[model samples]
Target: MKRKYSPYTLPPWLRKVRGACAQFIIPICVFQGIRTILFPFTLDVLLLTLLILLAVALHLNVI
Candidate 1:
């Protein structure tokens, strides 16, 4: 016999909020990368490299 698994499902509201949070975080990082690239004097090169790595990891779903 097969058993149904119900615990994996999330309510609509929770799903919406999670999606919103992801949307918010991704753009901010992207903007930071762009800003860093445009104005390299203000922030350290290592910080910019880390931000770019973060963006790549996000795209690759490593984070």
Candidate 2:
């Protein structure tokens, strides 16, 4: 029986990557979501939205 640190759920090596991702993801996602809604519509905005969706995939642990 043992307790583990949150980032230690992964293999010894991946803990760093996972921890880094968790640190930046939520704030970045929120910024993208807001930027998409506030600005004029354009292809660049569309690409940004798509990129934000990619962030959601990472946020959900699919990446």
Alpha-carbon lDDT, every model: 0.63, 0.69
Quote the lDDT for 50 in model 2. Answer: 70
**Cα miss at 60, model 2 (Å)?**
4.0
Best candidate (score: lDDT): 2
Once model 2 is optimally superposed onto the true structure by TM-score, how far is the C-alpha of residue 62 displaced, in angstroms?
2.9
Q: What's every prediction's RMSD, in angstroms?
A: 6.7, 6.4
Clashing pairs in 1: none
Per-model TM-score, in order, reads 0.39, 0.47
Lowest summed lDDT across 10 adjacent residues in model 2 is found at: 1-10
* Poorly placed runs, candidate 1 (over 4 Å): 1-43
lDDT of 2: 0.69
Clashes of each: 0, 0
Instruction: Write out the backbone clash pairs for model 2.
Output: none
Give residue 16's lDDT in candidate 2 (0 to 100).
Answer: 73
Q: Can you write out model 2's per-residue Cα lDDT over 1-63, one digit (the tens) per residue?
A: 875445446797686776677678777767766777887578658767776776777666655
